[model samples]
Target: MMTDTTQSRGRVEIDDVVIRFKGKQGTVTALERTSHVLEPGTFTSLIGPSGCGKSTLMNAIAGFVTPAEGALRLDGKPITGPSPEVGVIFQQYALFPWFTALNNVRFGLKQFGLSKREEIDRARAALDEVGLAAHADKYPQQLSGGMKQRVAIARTFAVEPKVLLMDEPFGALDAQTRLVMHDLLLGIWRKHKATVLFVTHDVDEALLLSDHVQVMSQAPGRLIRHYHLTQERPRALSRSGNELLEIRDEILGLLHPKTMLADTL
Candidate 1:
C-alpha cells in the first residue's frame, strides 16, 4: 500500500487491491496489489496503455467487481458491492433508447425513491447545467455522440453521487467535440467539486482533465508515475497543449521503461 500521510474530507483509500479473471487460455491478472488514496473532491485521471485494466480498477471502486485480495474504502469505511453513493458513467451512452433526455435523468432520480416533481425539477436542472435543456424532449437516437454523453452526465448528476466514475466518456467524439466536452466537464466539476476518477488511454486528455494523472503499466496494471497538475483549476483544454504535451511525453517514456531515464533527477 502507498503511504499517504495526509487526509481529506472525501477520502478514497485502496489497499493491496489484486484482481484476476479466469480464462480458457489462462488466468488473466488485471491488477496486482494496487493501492492509492484519492484526496477529497480531487479530479484524478487513470491513464495507461490498452489492456492495462483501468476499467477493471474503476469497477472495483464502483463495487461491480470484487478484488481477489485487499480492500477499498470510502470515508474510512470498507466498500463492498455496489453503493448508491458512487455513480458510474459508462463508455457508451447507457441510456434507454426510448426515453427522452429529461426522462433519462428523471429515471435515475426516481430509482432513488424521489418524488415525481422533485425528480423532474432535478433532472431538468441537471440537463440545463449541461446546456441540454433545449433538447430535453429528444431521445438518445436523436442526439449526437456528445449530446448522448451530455444526457448520461445529466442523469448521473441528478442523483448527486459522492464519487463520479467515468470511463472514456469522450473517446467516441471527434477531436474538436472532444475538446469542447472536456471544457464542459471542467465546468461541471468546478460547480459540484465531487471526487471524480476518470479512466482513459489518452495521455493529453488525462493531463487536461485531471489534477493528478496516474499512468499505469502494461499488464497486471500498476501505477508507474503520477503527473501532478499544480498549475491551476479551470484550466483551458485548448490552451494546455504545450504543458500537456510535455507530460504526455513523460508518460510515454514511463510506458516504455527500457527507454525511460532515471526515476528521480
Candidate 2:
C-alpha cells in the first residue's frame, strides 16, 4: 500500500482547458472549455465517440499538446512539458524492436541515476508484475502483440510515475488478451495507487475499470456527463447488474441517440 504522503501526490486539475488545431480551413477547436479534477490515486476513464477529442484532451494533460485557453496543473504545479512524473501509454505498443524486454523496462530507469544492480532489479520486478519476467530476454519481434504491450506497460511503471495516461492501450489486442491486460492493469493500479486517466470507447470497459467515467459529446468535444461507480473492485462483465446495465444504456444513448431510439421503438 502507498503511504499517505505518496497517495496525496497525483491530483490533476484541468482548469477550463481549450485545445485548438490550425488547418487549411481555419482554426478548429478540439476541446471546448473543459474543466475537471482527477482525484489523487483514483481511476478515471474518458469515453466518447470517435473524433470526439478524447485523445486530444489526454494529450494536453500529458503535456504533448498545449491547451490554448486554460491551465493544467498537477498538484498545484503547472504542466509545461513532458515529465517522467507523467507516463503515457498509447494503443500502439511503443516498444523498441532491438531491445530485449528487460532492457526496454530498464531504459526509463536509466534517467533516474539508479545503480546498475538496482536498475536491473527494479526492471525485473516490473516485468514480474506484468507476468513477463520469464520473457525478459525476448525481443519485441519475438513477442506476441499482448506481450509487446506488457513490455510497454512494464517500461512505463518501472519508473514509478505519479500519473498514468493510457489511451486505448489494449484496443489492438484480442478480446481475451484485452481482458488479461485489464486484470494486469488493475493489479498494478491497486499496488501503485497512481492516478490513472484511461481513454476507451467501450462502455463496459470504462465501467469495469474506472472509479469515475466521463462521457464526452461528438465533435468539438465537451464533457457531457460524469458517472461515479461505487461498485466493488474486480468487476466482471457477467456480473453487470441492473444498475450497471442502466448506466450502460444511458451512456450508449448519449453516444448514439439515433441507434438507441431505433432500438427502443
Judged by TM-score, which candidate is best?
2
Lowest summed lDDT across 10 adjacent residues in model 2 is found at 1-10
TM-score of 1: 0.89
Give TM per candidate.
0.89, 0.95
Q: Write the per-residue lDDT of candidate 2 for residues 1-265, one digit (tens) a residue.
A: 5345643579899999999999899999999999999999999999999999999999999999999999999888899999989999978988988899999999999998999999999999999999999999999999999999999988998888889999999888899988889999999989988899999999889999999999999989999999999888788756856788788889989999778555663
Which parts of model 1 have CA positions greater than 4 angstroms off?
1-9, 234-243, 256-265
lDDT per residue for candidate 1 within 69-112, as digits (tens), equals: 99999877788978767888888979999899999888878777
Residue 40 lDDT (model 2): 91
- Candidate 2 all-Cα RMSD: 2.8
| Clashes (N, CA, C under 3 Å) per candidate | 0, 0
Model 2 scores a C-alpha lDDT of 0.92
| Candidate 2 segments exceeding 4 Å error | 1-8, 261-265
